[model samples]
Target: MADPHIKSKMDWLDYVTVIAYRLGFTLAAPAILLLPWEVETGIPAQQLTFLAAMLCASSLHIYMKNFRLILQAATWGGLICAIFGFPLFGLGGAFVTLGGLCFKEYFCFRVPGLRAQPILLAALWLALVLNATLTAPMVVQGLAALSALLFLVTAVAKWRMPLHFDIGDKTKYEV
Candidate 1:
């Protein structure tokens, strides 16, 4: 059976978010791999690559969609090793990228009416913070920490909101 949650015609705003999410990932993936190479070659390359990844991550926030952006960002960060290569910028990208994924997952749970296991949520937060601490600039560490903090706070705030999520008016939790 086809998934009922799939909307036939996505709202224009939703479509825009999906496109932005894809573009962010497209630019982010290669930059993640190439950024570290910049270090051996020169800081110039590293800076450029980091800039690309950062732009992608920054752009993705507007959409709030769990699209290609998440995997691409993670792939890029993995290629570079979370907290090391091109300086704090690389590390910050890692945090933003992974943190974005974590946020997306939480948002998904809200709609799916699925509660994430507490341990899983904790691990996600830890992974992001650890990655940032290892690869990001000392100055960026604070920013990354703040970003992580924001993710947690936002998730909690949304959870407390009186909003009741439904898959669609047609479907109920019990089939």
Candidate 2:
């Protein structure tokens, strides 16, 4: 009889994954938003964020689904592009993965405001990528801020959840 309180190696890994994901988003949001002082830090926040995203995806326990692996691949693609001097393309790909994760969270946990996250993020990304004059800068910033808030709420909620919530039933996982 194993002690229920005794966490396995996988359990510890899950906690680490959640921590990395949450911290990555927490830092990446401000950095990408061009918050004051982020520029001075001179750190590659985007690259680090994508790396954390990849770790999160790798540790995700989506039973009977390859979607998690797909997300991981996207993060890798984004990271590679970012490292090779294609920051825009890398950011685009990484944001897509982030949006996907938000959608997944919304689908699974029904977090408030998350349902609109992907759309808002996509619109913001498109506006920036296309340099669309049709959409005002204020609107773009508003969307980014909103998306960040939604992510913050979701991350906080997830942080409060037990590790098992993320790990789910190991029995159902594909071998």
Candidate 3:
């Protein structure tokens, strides 16, 4: 049986979001790894292998959409860790979350819908990415926290959502 909630149409907007999401993640994943590496190792010349692996993993979401949700979650988690952890714990903190993300996304992404909708995730990704380089840290932290909250709320709701969650549709829970 197929899941009703899963839709993979070829809408133009989907193309835009998918491209942006994939490209952004591809670029971001390497930085997520390399930042701490450079911080500790002072920029190794042979880091391309790690970067290539990250790129491959990022692109895997396209063919294997089931685990994409988990991947998305990890992606956000990485952003959170890198943005906040980098400043707080330095290299170790950054690698901790980044490594956890890669491990989970690579091994456990098929666990279920533990991720928010792709569209919402894309917006959050944009928020984290754009704000990550700002001069002010507080603003980025605030946005990252909000995005994580939003993702969690939507994800939980998605899992526990009433069957008839369509727009204004009423369900037994209302009665």
Q: Which candidate's TM-score is highest?
A: 2
- Order of quality (lDDT): 2, 1, 3
Off by over 4 Å in 1: 1-4, 40-90, 99-175
What are the RMSDs of all candidates, in order? Answer: 13.1, 4.7, 14.8
Instruction: Tell me, by lDDT, which candidate is best.
Output: 2
Q: What ranges in model 3 sit over 4 Å off?
A: 1-9, 25-66, 86-175
For model 2, the stretches where C-alpha displacement exceeds 4 angstroms are 1-10, 35-45, 48-52, 132-135
Model 3 Cα lDDT, one tens digit per residue, 68-175 = 444444544444544564433222222332233333432333323323333333333344345446435454344334434433333343344322221121121121
- Please, what are the lDDT tens digits per residue for candidate 1 over residues 76-174? 664476345544444554545544444454555442311332233234334434554564443333433343344444345434432222122223222
State the C-alpha lDDT per candidate.
0.41, 0.64, 0.35
* Model 3 local distance difference test score: 0.35
Q: Poorest 10 consecutive residues of model 3 by lDDT?
A: 166-175
Residue-level lDDT tens digits of model 2 in 67-122? 76676677778778878998668767777777787887777677887778778777
Which ten contiguous residues of candidate 2 have the minimum total lDDT?
A: 1-10
Candidate 1: Cα lDDT at 7 = 38
Better of 2 and 3 by TM-score: 2
Error of 2 at 43 (Å): 7.0
